[model samples]
Target: MQSIEKYPHYFNSIKEVHENIQSIIPEIAGAYKNKYNLSFPVDINLIVGGFGSNAYTYRQIIPNITFALEKLSPNPDHLRVIVAHEFGHLAQYIMLDDAGMDWSKSRWTHPLIWLYREGIATHLSRQIADNIHPSVYFSYNDEGVQWLTFAQANMIRIKQAFMEDFKALTSEKLFHEWFSINGGNRFGYSRLAYFLGNRFVLEYMEKHGEQATIIAWREENFEAKIAQWLSQEGVDKSE
Candidate 1:
């Protein structure tokens, strides 16, 4: 795997943050490979910008993993969580490819599908970081901890709220409602899907085991399996 670093002037001004990322790259990559079983070479790029701290994987001639280092906590542990989460996406893509599935064909517009993808990544991130230490896994940042706490505390309510709207909504409508800032906030929580998805993954892992969960995710009938699991748990999706 190859790595590239690009720091904005402001980012370069912070010696610790820059140095922390440099120090953490190998650890992140090592954890990713050992945990996720991903062996393909990926181009990992770190960029400093104001667009918000997020990571994306671009599959072109090679898999390009890019992380935007804006609005991120300077804490190295926090950065590790972000890196692990992003690497989860890369792992997902590789798994899909191995399963003879095209990542481009993923139904991003579907809220459930989007939730599963993000949730799995979040779950993997937590697992990867926890392998180092429990504190690093759980207390990466205040907002993340708060959001996760809120999500867990209100999981049933969130599921009920989602079920109430899932039937009548189209994929596009569902995506907008569940993922968009204004739409997400309408249900008294924003980005609820991330938490919900994480819960879903956790449930699956609890029942099926981690490697099985990953395999299930790669299968074409993954959503159907999720729906069945939800039904078994009495999560009503019918109108």
Candidate 2:
């Protein structure tokens, strides 16, 4: 893909971002290698005009790896986190393969998959970025500022609940459901999905290694397994 000099002027130049993203790969791989003990190819693409100004994994038959950025040099700390997060996904994907996941036939809605995909990156990204909140960030502000208002509220709740407890926020069934419900374009829902998935996996990491977590995430019935996570878990549902 031709490099679109479209790196938002509010951030760094495309060339700068390209260098940063490229240079971080070895450090990223090394971090996970020591933590999870696995290796995977990391090929990222710089794509703007995406639904999110975040990094994500591109799934293909061969999984041509990708990690997108909303802006070239969005807050340096955030950029570092996003890159590390996407790289985390690459690492987890390799772990999933080692565990014999049947990705080609998988439905992709598995909640555990959400956690594995979003959480590992989240956990690692926070570290690389030296972030205070391991899985959350704030954008805008104000009530009429719909996105900021909601995110701020969610952040408060997350810190009170998930940040401390973690298990209370972990759920496979509701993860994808929230993804669809909050994702149309109307704001905070989709972003909330990212943090939810991450928090769940960060907790999972404590109990399971990367490979085991990936396999569990890819399991066909995790959504069903996590069916009652919301109503019974006791995290404010008033969002």
Pick by lDDT: which candidate is best? 1
The segments of candidate 2 whose C-alpha lies over 4 angstroms from its true place after superposition are 1-12, 47-54, 67-70, 109-116, 127-190, 202-211, 218-220, 235-239
Q: Pick the TM-score winner.
A: 1
lDDT tens readout by residue for model 1, 1-239: 11224345346534565678777777877887786667658777777554543556674423678766654556777878877877776677677677666656555445567778777778778877764433333334545555555666666777776766677778767766775544565456566766667778877788888766664655666677655544444442210
**lDDT (CA) for every model shown?**
0.64, 0.50
- Per-model TM-score, in order, reads 0.75, 0.62
Compared with the true structure, the alpha-carbon lDDT of candidate 2 equals: 0.50
Worst 10 residues of 1 by lDDT: 230-239
lDDT for 7 in candidate 2 is 38
10 residues in a row with least lDDT, candidate 2: 135-144
**Superposition TM-score, candidate 2 onto the true structure:** 0.62
- Cα displacement (angstroms), candidate 1, residue 69, comes to 1.4
Instruction: Give candidate 1's error at residue 132 in angstroms.
Output: 8.3
